[model samples]
Target: MAKVKGEIVINSERCKGCELCVPVCQQQTIAMSDKLNSKGYHYAMSINDECNGCINCALVCPDGVISVYRVKLKDAAVA
Candidate 1:
């Protein structure tokens, strides 16, 4: 079986800083930025590479600011 890895992209300008996606993430990869966006809000950010492509954050985001990408890594023996 292959292992799944994921990446999360966020449009800081589009984000409203609602913090809706923060708690929904099971991996706790999402966080609020220390800096503010152009809209003067703390945008969402992926704090680490632990994302599993769950899409929970994307689904909960009202502004559609989050994007998730997943890749599969084959076993080392197979590689």
Candidate 2:
């Protein structure tokens, strides 16, 4: 199985709640939160297990609020 390693950041204040990122995500990792932010808008959050670090969310974000990062995995010790 391929390992997915990355982080996503959504600027809730900048988000327009258009859900443009929701459908484009192939992994179905991105979703709109039920809780509202200070701007009274629902923001997008990612499910860790569902995301594959494909960077689709960032590409779909009109406000440029989304960010993606790839994590470096530690190598296993040689026995």
Candidate 3:
């Protein structure tokens, strides 16, 4: 099986800083941004490129602010 990587996108403007997405991410890829959004809240941001596309964050996000994409690692052998 090929190794999989994930890309996570968060709509910071739409994020309400609910912190729901953080705990669900086992990879700890998501975090609250130091900067504030237009709504004056610390929005969610991708802190690292370690997401595995589990979609747990998306499922827990009440505002639908998260999107996840899965990619097969180029060097990984496929069977």
Instruction: State every prediction's TM-score relative to the real structure.
Output: 0.90, 0.78, 0.88
Ranked candidates, highest lDDT first = 1, 3, 2
The sequence of per-residue lDDT tens digits that candidate 2 reaches over residues 12-51 is 8788788999999877878998988788889888865656
lDDT of 1 by residue, 18-77 (tens): 999999998899999999998899999999878889899999999998989988766873
Residue-level lDDT tens digits of model 3 in 1-79: 4288888889999999999988989999988999999999899999887788889999999999888899877763433
Candidates in order have lDDT scores of 0.90, 0.78, 0.89
Instruction: Quote model 3's TM-score.
Output: 0.88
In candidate 3, list every pair of residues with a backbone clash: none
lDDT of 2 at 62: 85
All models, RMSD in angstroms: 2.4, 3.1, 2.6
Preferred candidate (TM-score higher): 1 or 3: 1
Selected candidate, larger lDDT, 2 vs 3: 3
Q: For all candidates, what are the clash counts?
A: 0, 0, 0
Top-scoring candidate (lDDT): 1
Model 2, CA-based lDDT: 0.78
lDDT of 2 at 60: 77
Candidate 2's C-alpha runs over 4 A off are 72-79
